[model samples]
Target: MSSVSGLVKTEQLYRSQSGWLQRAFAWCGWENGQVMANIRAGRMLTDYGRYHLSRKQFIFAAIAAALVFYMAAYLFYHSALVSIAAAGFGIIAPRFRRRSLLQQRKERLKLQFKEALFSLTSSLAAGRSLENAFLATLDDLKLLYPDPRTELLLEFQIIRFRLENAEPLEYALRNFADRAGIDEITQFTDALAACKRSGGDLLEVMKRTSAIIGEKLEIEQEIAVMIAQKRFEGRIMMAVPFVFLAFLSLAAPDYMAPLYGGIGYLLLTAALLLLLLCFWAMAKMMRIQM
Candidate 1:
């Protein structure tokens, strides 16, 4: 009877301890179940413009940023408190990095789409059916991309599969555009759908659309080249303040000694904030939306 009572008490104690641990983790934002759910959702939600970072990449980025910020903080303030505070920014750095990567990937995908349209136009003009034209475009893309898994190629494969399964070409194109989430792609898909429904000359329509998209992409490239110098200047300007401060600290430590503590720290903080705001404003100004 005593053994049975002891066993029951032990089991109850274990359950209580486990429950307490779960609550503690939840309070600390470390709920295992929730974290797993978020990771899974992030993986599953990845689409054209949404990229997922692997666990290795995320950990590497965080550690790299933490170390860089820690060094920068120590260099600027020579204070452990400021270094720790700056290290905290590393937690969010990976998110910004991932967003930048996604944007670049989208831009590359858009350019690839423009190239695919040229092949598609040629195939259609050469008397291939729309479905065959996509297949021909895929082949051409394979030659240009040298990758069997490029985004445009994958999209074309999906559309080809849908067409083979008896789905309407218009439906497939619409779905592709929706997934792509690019204004240019959406416009092309709309035009294609309208042309198909009205039984218009698809070859001419595709040729015209391809020409327009190609011209626009060329113009955008030219604009990027024209503004490249301005972008470089903006970036240099953003770095000038930090570089100057670092120089002052190294070249004349006594000169910057007064900015080390007390009200000096507050002033330094305000100055850093102002510099960040200026950098952000300059970056926004340099970003030309095409």
Candidate 2:
């Protein structure tokens, strides 16, 4: 019986060692198949303590806080109101910061995408395959953009890992689209999958797509220039009043004090808010869908 127990222990140790070896190889790019499987299942690296949180986690956190507040209110009635409010605020603070960070990351990603696409197109035109184009684009992005470039590179690494795991090219491409949330990428992935399955002409498709993308980018640049001009004009117009008022107040404080303190403040605040709303609306309207 003791001998059998010892043999079982040895087998378990061997299995543990094998698992460790598999994981190490996976991290080193040897296990692309498993990496692909993980990506298709939406299990990527995440920092719950910092930027991103799942919707389910957010809901659960809110529910937990609500339950805690309900219990506190029930037990102490009015005495624990302050504590309950404080606890609720604490619970919501993390959610707010998480959302803010996600938005910031998203904006940075959007800002970098035009250059990324141009780089990819240039690489494709130079006779590089799609995967190599993306890899090259990642390097170009790292040099041109900021932190979001690093995020995009990490995504490319994840996709490469997935490919190593024996995941199909289509599966890996689909995973890339889902992770990036980019419609252009999703369309490109779908098109590539179709071409692969049917043995179609990928080079032609890429060339045509690249030309169209360049034209659209040109139009977008024109729109951005117009918007910037409008924004600049608005700023100058808004500043003119303040500048005139400063001169007036400094030149004749007794005469202009009431006007500057009352009507000027209210109008300035209203104008600023209106300008911000307009800017936000214009940005949303100008967002190109893919």
Best-fitting candidate, scored by TM-score: 1
lDDT of 2: 0.61
Q: Given candidate 2, what's the lDDT at residue 45?
A: 68
TM-scores for every candidate against the unseen true structure: 0.80, 0.49
Clashing pairs in 1: none
TM-score of 1: 0.80
- Stretches of model 2 off by over 4 angstroms after superposition: 1-133, 136-149, 257-290
Q: What lDDT tens digits, residue by residue, belong to model 2 across residues 181-265? A: 7555566677778887898787777666666655665675577677668767766664565466456656876765454354655
Distance from true location, Cα of 139 in model 1, Å: 0.4
Question: Which candidate leads the pack in lDDT?
Answer: 1
Q: Write the per-residue lDDT of candidate 1 for residues 68-164, one digit (tens) a residue.
A: 7887778667888889999987766667667777777788888999998888898988999988888888889888987875778777878878888
